[model samples]
Every structure is written in structure tokens, then in C-alpha cells.
Target: MARVLSLVAAAGAATLAAAANPHAAMGGYQPATNVIEHSQIVYDIEAIQTALSADDFTEAKNIYMNGKYSCKSTSNMRNLQGFVKQATYDAKLNGTAFVDAFVDGDGPSYGPIPGSGGRLMLSPTFWDDFLLGALDGTGDFLGMSTAIRKVAINKGVLGVSTLYAAYEMESAIGKKYDDNSADASGAPHAWDEGWAFLYGSHPADDGKYSAWEFSKKRDLDFAYNSSAQAVEGATVATDMLLKYFLHGLRASRSGGVLADMVAARNNIYRMLALSSIRAALKYAEKAQNPYNEEYHMEAYVYFLVAANWVEQAYAGAGTNVLALLDFKKTEAQLSSNLYCAVKTELVPSYQPLGLDCAKVGVLKGHDDTLDDNCNAPACPATQTLPTGLDSYVPDVTTTVGS
Candidate 1:
């Protein structure tokens, strides 16, 4: 298992390195689950540790050809679409100035995410949506995920890396957000930042913000924050990349459906995390400032509702199954989490979109009591209206004290 895992990771690293040239020779090739596996990616890591190792142009070109096929999966394309579109959106609105705002001032929003034909983009939503689609079944998140992972992994191994290199004198620093900046202009956040941004920490826990505004970025931490979120769009991404690196190696040698399934789940869960965070952030944004502990607690319900949908998708990732096909324990988990803070005071009406909060839970008003299970018969905001189709919760600002 260890050897197989190593191979999968190495293949992706190698593929990332070999992406520059269109033609490259691979030593051993076996069709693994409809995707071409690369042995050289793992095995040849020692021979080539730096980009300079590919001394000859011919050496560089050979492995590059195989890298293209790695990211050509349909699953990867949607990722390309989500990420590219989001990046275009980000760039259009924020410009490249904030592109690499995650790690330091020089960071970007996402990663060297591969698009069609191995073109890389640094958009966080690319992988976020790919992971979400894996659970929902409306899209081919699996194929695109594998393709991108494989190529990126392979390139890293060959030392002629595609992603880690510099572009426009920038090393492509990823963007991270301070606890604030969950959204801009009070727009709902659609990725994982919402999760940590909203429910991840209590407002009083940290003192970095002027007001508890989601539009502002957080510069500190309180609870389970990740480098991905810490850097702007930096949280939860490396985990996916690392999972892909590990899974590719396992699938390479073991050649089992389980490894591939894990790889698939990694992508899905990774995105689900992002989606949940985005929703929570949006909810917090709408909740506005001067929010008390009750405000955050109530806001948490919408975020968890979003989480429930995301978890449904992540839980089913092990099988190439549709997450929304049926509600299961994970949804219950979401409900339970919601109960902790949200159901107590849900306002009413709900919406379901990519991480919509309504379907999960809602706050009626200040009477939401965690001490009492969400069995509040007269509770106005709380309802488990069957999980099918998507709708928006009515604007409960007046009722919920928004």
C-alpha cells in the first residue's frame, strides 16, 4: 500500500513537471482504471530533483505528452470551468493584484490548477466546484479531478514543473483571507471560507477585526483554520493536492477501485469543505455586524445547512454515487451541528443552491434553545422540508433581527 501510494503521488508530481513539452517517453505504461498511470513519475524522482535535470529538450518533451492525458478527464474539465470562470470573475473584479493574496501579500487565490490541455489557473473555486460535483452527480467531477492531479503530480516529479514556476515574475503566491473578507459587498460566499469564517470561530474569540464584517479579511486565527483559508483562498487546497498525490501512487501499483475512489472522494470532500465555508461566510455577511454570540450561533445554522448538502456529497464520494440522490446520516450530522447554534432561532423559508443554507436549517427568532431539541412545534424558522430541488429562504432579516 505504501509503495502504491508513493507511485500515485509521484506520478502527479512528475506530470506537473513534464507539462511544458508535448512529447515525452514513459518507461512503463499500464491502463489503470481508464487512465494512463505513470511509473516514471514515482520511480524517477531521485534521478531528476530539479528542473535543470531535464538537460536536453528531447527529455523534457517526451514526458510532457503523457501529462496532457492525465488532465484530460471530463471531471477535470468542470474543475477547469469552475476555477477558470471564478478566476476570471476574481480577476475581473479584483484584478491580479489580489491573485496571490493567500500566503503573504504576494499570494494568489488558488493554485496552479490545470485546465483544458494542461493549462493552469490559480482560482480556488476550480477545485471547490470539482469537489462539489463529485458528490452531486450533476457533473463529471471525477474525471477532471484525476486528470489534473495526475498531470500536476507527474510534472512535480520530472523537475520541469509547470505549476510551481514563476509567471510574470510572480511565484504564483496563493491568496489567504483574514477571518474577514468572507465576501465582497455582502455577496454570499460560495466556498469553504464561509465554514471557518462563520462557524469556525466565535467573533469574541479574536480581536483582529474592527467589526464582525465578512467582507473584511481575517489576519489571525481561533479554531480549525487551514493555510488555505488563512492565505485568502489557501485553506483546504493542499490537502486535496496531497491526497491526489498519495492516491495516484496507490492506484498506480494496487490497481484497485478503492484507491481511485479515495482519490475521487478526496477531491469531493476537499471542495465540500470549501463550499461549506463559503456558505457560512455568506450567511455571516448577511447577518451583518454588532452580532452577539446569539447572532453567530444563529448564523451557524445556515452554514451547517450548507454543510449538510456538502457532506451528503462528500460521504458518497467513496462510491461514484450522487450525493443528493438521498438524505442520509451526514445530513443528520449537519442538522445536529445546526441544532447546536442555528435551529434555536431560525427565521424561516430556505434556499438550496451551491451551499445554500435554508435546506439545512433556519432561525425563527431569539427563542431557539439548544437545551431543547429542535422539536419546537411552533418554531417558525425550523423545517425539514424534503431535500429535493433548490429554493431560497425568504428574507428573514426583519424576523431574525438582521
Candidate 2:
């Protein structure tokens, strides 16, 4: 027990240290000045959101299907458009009724988010399918706002952008580069594309409406309050993620070895998984409160996203994580106990990714009394990696990106 506590303390210290000097990557890093051509996709997504707010489905559909954004040309964004178009169509037909169900009787509001705009939570299927289902009248409208803002825009657009970034990273790995121009062919262009998808038109410091905002939201969600021990915990995960991207780009530009690029890509993947886990934990806490359907859906969407990455991080434990984050569970079935189990299950998955599980802090604004059963023995203070994962290596290292 003493040794476990010490390990947890050390992990916290390491996370704080990384948080304090996130740019400690070899050679100082700067945001790339190249134009992120596809970044307008994020803007397009916001426009669609605004259109939906005004019950302007035709306008939303036009922006989604006919927008002049460069990202629309990308295969990934194009793939997402079909889904977004369907959602927008359903919204055009049913959104007014859905909005009427809300106490506010208006479209989703952006003011309540951690940052300035809507929350950009991601999911490949759970939220995606649910959003479509809700809009099509198969699912309840109780959480329809969450379905639109989080799933349709965030998952369908920004999340797909991040996935594209991941694709670019894979493309850049083990490849030779001639120059670092954004227009350059091969690895250089791929690296820039990765950066654009994640950072998108806005500077990193003031990033919005893209994967950057999602990362920031997770950072704020998991951040511990200021203390003598750590002043920068709030942005630790976000900073680390940015640092990884910058480092990876530098390696691509300078013709560095596959190992460096691989390290950066893996770290980015780790942070993605960590951020998803943090989000899941946060909404799980919120879901424990009675009478908030949105919170329940939020918890489920993030947990589903986290599960996808967790499966990648630890192949052997994939089934267990998926079971814990089951998409079939209804709002009433989501509980603190289930999330507590999730937290415990995920603890082991963090170590191999170089993340400190202990730093997955509890989100503020929740009543602790509500989650009393999740503490201590029920959830356990320490959990070991599932029996085989400690020895099982992830396939991500060996899979070549196309």
C-alpha cells in the first residue's frame, strides 16, 4: 500500500512537471505558420451549428454538403458529410419539435461549455448513431441538443479531422521528406495536414471549434486546482498533446528517424485516449446526478470514445473496456458504480502510454455525497493492468499507415 501510494505520488509529480514545461521537447517549439487549408471545415461546422440554432436546416445542409471548405475535398471530411447531411435533414424535419422538449425551448447553447463554443466530444458510432437516431425520431429528444452539438458536429466533423490527423501521422512515419512546405508532397505535406486538422485556422493559444478545443475542454475538466505543488495542471494534458504534435512536425521537417515520429504519434494517441478518459470520468460524475438526460448522454459518448482508444492502447483488455462502456446502456442504467469500475479498469491502460492515471482528476461542480459508494473498496485505490496486457504489445506499433 505504501509503495502504491508512493508510485501514485511520483506519477502526479511527473505529470505536474510535464505540465509545468510542456514545451521541453528537444529544441523549443513554435506553432507552424503554414496555412491549414482544411481548417475552414471547423468554421463550416460552426456555421451549421448556428444554422441549426435558428432552425435553418436548409442552410445547415447547404453548409455541410456544399460548403467551399478545402477540407470537404479530403476523403475523411467527405466521408463525414454523408452522415452530417442525414442528421441535418432529420433536423430540418424534426428539430423544432426536439427543441420544444427542452425547458429553454431553443437550440443548444454554447455558453455553458468550458470554452467559448460548443463541446466537441467525439465518438465513431455510439454518439454518431444516437444523434442520427434522435434526429430521425427513433431515440428520445431529451438529449437531442447533446446529440446535435457533440455528435453531429464534434464527432462527425472535428473528431473526424483529428482522425485524419492521425492518418497523416501514420502516412508520415518511416517516409523520407524533401522539404517542410505545406504544399510539399509526401511526409512534409502529411505532417502539415496532421497539424491543420488538429490546430486548424486558429493559433494554438486561442484555438476554437476544432480538436484543439476538445483537448482544452478535457484539460479544464481534469485540471486540479492551484496548489504549491503544481500551478499548471489545468493545461497539462493539452500542453503535452501540443508538444507532441510540434515535436512530430519537427521530426518530419528535419528528416528524423522513424522512431522519433513514432514516439510523437504514440504520445498523441496516448493523450487522445487520456483526454477521452478524463471526459468520460467527468460526465460520469455528472450523470450520477438525477434528472439530467444530457449529462447521461455526455457520459455515454465520452466513455464510448475512450473505449475505442483504450482498445488500441491495450489490445488484451479491449473486451473488458468495451463491456464497461457498453453503448446499449440507457440513461438510467448509467451509474457512478459503473464509471468507478471504468476508472479502475482504465488505470492499468495508462501506464504503458506514459500517462499518469492518478492525474485523471475528478471534475468539479458535483456533489461528492452522491458518489460515496464509488470510493475506496468499491472502486479500489489501486488496480493492476489486466492479466495479459502487461505483456501484450499493441498492434499500433507494427501497423503501417496507408
Candidate 3:
């Protein structure tokens, strides 16, 4: 869901190729494994930045919306992508002025209200007519199939697999909202809120949807590293928790067969949480350079904390694997494999919007230094991993970037 432009284009083309054929996903061509590799990542980042800078707003906008939530039909990526392509291209063609006017500013634009999602406006490049290609091709327009099928229809393997990433984030946040509303102690709204709890994420708290909207309108000028990378992933492990609570606490209150739905939702949430935790941990661990161990160390600490939280999810529910699944470790010895953060950060520091209060490293008898590893005093950053973010370590004597 957070894939950059080149990835989206590549995915779009791939989806096109796949839809054209019966076996594109199964055997069309191997998708690039370097989806998240550093050079490729940095290059894509720079390319998009440069494109935006050159006021090649047309190409850039095409990249934004088409990439976020692509629409691949039964035939090709091109068929489904035109509407968004035009909408995005128009947004970029108008530049920031258009974005402000239509998206969030004072001109004629879509408001926060759901009914007014957005509209299709053609760019100078494709002004064949008013509604030829721009208005109808976009899946987000009216009645797109609300299913996982949409995700697969529009993405390359890497992009599609990560679709679940966005889904999980949105769903988790939705669960949080459900949790909030259900706690209101009113039976009607509480009953009204059951659909939200037992299903995937909702339209209201959808960060991806908002992000996609930002792109569609060209307000996507956000600095990637600065704003919303994997902030969705951060909550992946947390939201599965609502499932446990629902299964344990609200299952009785499910008003009959809704209880079964509760259990199924719980299972789905558990699978998503466990898989997301495992996948993100793999990605974070890959960031380790010789001397740098900051971002992922924080991630590890969170993983452990999430692991601990999962235990509470199943405290009295008898024996269950959902808790054990978080860290991919057995509950009988989760402590041994787990790492907890004793170090702390400012209470909500991940964004300019705010900082997050969190313990920062895994607590272990182990050391955070090369000396502890019986190596030199200062560990060296390698070509495989570039390590410079370790300057703010709380307890390590041999800190990098100090």
C-alpha cells in the first residue's frame, strides 16, 4: 500500500500482463526481489522527488494515485488505471494549487465528508472529452468490489502482498474504533457497531484511504522518511488484540451467531498480526549495519512489548496460540527469546506531529557493543548495512555517531 511510484508502475504493468494472461502471477515473470533494497529504495525516492521538482507534475501525479491503490481489471492494469491516472495527473498538472483547491482548500473540492470522496478532472495531456477516460476508470469512484480481490487485481507480487499490510493497518484501527464505540454502554449503537468489530478495517479511520486521497489530490508532497512510513505497520501487532478481547469479553454479547463471526474475526486478526510482526521484524533486522542499531532496536523492543501484551490477551481464555504467535516463540519460554526495552524515549517522538513514549531496547544480559561481542571498541559499519543512527543510545558505552 505504501509502495512508491516506480513500484506501482511496474506493478501496474505486471498486473496488466497478468490479466492479459491466465498465469501472470503464477508464472508471468519473477517480480523484483529488490523491492526494498537500499539503492533501489533510495533511487525511487530520489526519482519521485526529482520528478516532482521538475514540475513534471503530470507524471508524478500518475505515480501517486495509480501506485497507492491500483485497479487491475480482468484484462490489464491500463484498463482500470485510467480514471485514477487522469485524476492524479490533473491534480499534479494543477500542482499544489489544484490540490489545495479541490482536496482541502477553499475552492470547489471534496470535503472530509465520505459522500464527497473526490472527483475526476482530466489533465491537459488527455483532454479528449469530459468523461471518456478520467471519470469512470478509477476503481475508487463508485462501486469497486470491496474485497481482497481488488488488491490482487492491481499490484505486482510485492505490491499485492503488501496490500494486506495496508488492510491490516486499516482493519486494526477500525477495531480500535469499534472497541471505543462498543464501550459506550448503549445497546443500539453497540449493536450497530458489531459489523465494524467483526469485519476488516472501516472507511472512517483508514490511513491508507487518506493517504491515497492525498495522492489523488497531489498533496502527496510529504517527505517519506519524515511522515508515514510503516506507521501502519507499527499498529499491526497492536490491533490483533481487539480480537482476543472480542473473543473473550464480547463473544457472549455477540447476540447469537455474531459470536461465531467474532471468533472468525479473531482468527483472521491473529493471522494478520502474527504474519505482520514476523515480516516487519525481518525488514527491520535487515537495517542493521556494523555499528548502527537504533531504529530496529526500537522495533525489537516494541515487538517484545507486543508479545507481552498478547499474553494478557489470553490470560484467562485457557490455552491459546494467538499470544505465542506474536513473537513466533512459545509461551512457555517467551521470556528467553524475547527482548524488552528498559530504555525510554520521549512520550510520542516518531513524528513532528508528536512523539511516542516507549522503552527502547531489548533487555537482556547481552551487550550493545562490539566489546561485548569480543570485537574492537568501535564496531564498523559495513557496505551491507550502513549504520549511523545509533548516536542516541541510552546505555551503550560504544555508541555510533556520538
Candidate 4:
């Protein structure tokens, strides 16, 4: 079993580096002659944004749920559409109340999440509890509003973009980049797919001044707070990420051996994973107050998601890059320390407010809970709370006093 797991991880890493030149020795292949068109998802987001600006959220929500909008034209696959469908189904099953509560702003509030029909990937019930608790409207609306806004823009909008770009890359790599086919345009197409992930359909001809010009624009607007330092940090992070994507995209465009381009793509994916983890940690920092347990927990949800992505991306990297990032240490921090804490401390203690331990997210249907009990071996007898992520330490000593 361990050997199989190792092979699977190695295969995943190797595949990310698989966009090799098909006719490397033939000497007859021409340089890419075509420009990759803007993905259909780009226009879909434009329309969605228009609806949002017009306060037509009902229509916007419908468009999002149905996946009726245009997807990437580069590939016949409906990767964006599939993601929308899955997201909608998950939301309905686990986050109906959270989505609906924010949908109208004045509609029905948070309600019970339904039982798992298939199997839970992550628990919406636990997520909702943290979000509701964090955003109780007691301290201020900034934290709550920021959380919702980030969710809407990052998860809803840019999430589609990332999936679309990844799908295009998959198509090119799977086909081995044969320009003779409609789906494959060699390095140019593969590079463009990755470019679109960070920059969207935004024309590069225009001057790039602000970090907001890229996918991280809405991120800045939604993560608003009184602290100037926090905003500045987000800005810097967004810009750094943009620079990496842009450079990688250019490298991909410049005619080269497929190995180099593949490495560029892998590194870009690595940055994406890291940037997301940083964002989650920052959000977690904002949710540290005892009065804001909900937000604190919700931040971890994002953290876990980011950590999972990093695990996958890091598995794809070469030894040099792996050593530079110290990925094994990072993975231990995520899979061992943080994972154990979430399983033991965060989820169980919040149960009195109606969280169900049995429903906590298990890995691929395998329950790792201690003795298969949700509340047993309760948060170590010596420690008041889990250690390690002290930056996200929750104030468990006192109840919120209004």
C-alpha cells in the first residue's frame, strides 16, 4: 500500500512535467503559428460581474448554478461547467444556508445542513458553524463581509478561471502538443492556458500598474479592513504572484524544449498553492479573537483546502525545487500537526453549538478519527487548545458577552 501511494504521488509529479515536444528529433515541426483565443469562461465572468454590478444576483446565482455560460474553447472538455455543477451541488448539500443567507442579504438566516448523500469531501456543517460564529455581527461587519466577499470572488470567480486554464494545459500535455490538431498548438497553447489562469482575458497590451489588474483585483476590494498594513501585504503578495505567472507565461511562449516549459508550469502551480496558503493564514490571523470563533474556523477550512493543493503540486516538483521549498517539512506541518489539531480540537469543541463530529471531513472515505469517536480522547488533557498554529489561537476561556 505504501509503495502504491508513493508511485501515485510520483506519477502525479511526473505528469505535471509531461508537456514534451512531440517531434523533438523530427526537425520538421514548425514554431507555433497561432495565438490561443480567450477562454469562454472569461466572457462568462464578465457577464456575471455585470449582473452583480446591476444587483441582479438572482440571475447571477442562476447562471453560476446552471453552468450555462461559455467555457474554454481551446478544448472540447467542459471543465469549467463541471466545476460549476459540482460547486452548486456541494453548496446545496452543505452550504445552502450560507449561500442563501448571503444571496439576498435579508433573506432567511443560517439553517441545518443536510446529511451526506454520497460522501463528504469536506464538512459544510463544520464550515458553516465557524463562519456563523465568526460573523455573528457582534464586533464589526468588516471581518464577516471580508470573508463572504473573498468566498464569492476567489472561490466563485477565479476558481472557474483556474480550472479552465488547467484543463487546457491538460489537453496540450495529453496530446503531446501536436500542432497538426485543432486542440494542440504546441508550446504557445500550453503557455497561454497558464497565462489566462492568472491574467484572465485581460489584454497584456495595456499597461500593468496595479496588482488589481489581474485575478487578484477583486481579492483586494473584498479583503478590505481598517488595517493598512494587512491591505499592503495582500497587495504585495498578489503582485509577486502576478510576476511569477507573467514570467512563466512568457517563457512558455518563447519557443523552447518542452521540458523547460513544463517546469515553468509546475513552478507556477507551486506558487499558486503557496500564495493561497498565505492568504488563508492571514485570514486566520484576523479571526483569532474569542468572539470570532466562526471566522477562525472558516479560515482553517480555506487553509486545509490550500494545503491539499500544495501537497498535490509539491508532489509534482523535481528534487531541486522540492529541496528549495523544504516541501517535506511543509507537508508535515499540514498533514500531521494541523491535520491532527483540526480533527481533535477545532471540530469537537464546537459541537455544543450543533456541529456533528461524525460528519467531519475524512480523507477519501477513510475515517482517521481516534477510535472512530468524534469527541473521544478530547483535546489533550494538558493543553487548553492545540499548539503549532498559535497565530490562529482561539480564545476558549470566555463566552462572548454582549
User: How good is model 1 by TM-score?
Assistant: 0.22
RMSD of each: 23.3, 15.2, 22.7, 20.2
TM-score of 4: 0.41
Top candidate on TM-score is: 2
Which prediction has the highest lDDT against the true structure? 2
Per-residue lDDT for 1-402 in model 3, tens only?
222433334434554421232111101111111112111222222333445456453543354334322222333222112322346345432332122212232222211111112221213322222112222334322332212122212211222122222222223233333443232232212321222212212123321221122121111111112343432212222233333323322322223233332343333333332332332233233323431233333233223312211222322111122232222222343322221111111111122111111111111222344123232122112211111111110111111110
TM-score (C-alpha, index-matched) for candidate 3: 0.22
Which portions of model 2 miss their true places by more than 4 Å?
1-33, 57-62, 71-156, 177-183, 203-205, 224-235, 315-328, 375-402
Residue-wise C-alpha lDDT for candidate 1, range 1-402, written one tens digit per residue: 112233334434554331231111111211112112211122222222222233332332333322222232434311112222355445532332222221112223332211111101223343334323432323542333332333222222211111111111121111112222112111111121111111111122321111112212211221123442333223332233223323322222222233242233234333333333443433343333332332233233223322322322332221111121111212233333332333222212121112223222222222234435544224234222212112111111111000
**Could you tell me which 10 consecutive residues in candidate 1 have the lowest summed lDDT?**
393-402
Candidate 2, number of clashes = 0
Q: After best superposition, candidate 3 residue 171: deviation in angstroms?
A: 10
- Model 1 spans with C-alpha error above 4 angstroms: 1-237, 252-260, 263-271, 278-286, 290-402
For 1-402, candidate 4 gives per-residue lDDT tens digits of 000122223323442222432111001111122221332344455555666566565555555444433433423323333443445335432223222121212111211212111111233233222322323422223344433433343233544454345444443433333422222354445544444443433233221211123324323432333342233223232444444443433334424334443444444443344344433433333443322434443343444322323333222111112122221222233322233333332332222211132212122212244224344334222211111111111111111110
- TM-scores for every candidate against the unseen true structure: 0.22, 0.63, 0.22, 0.41
**Which scores better on lDDT, 1 or 4?**
4
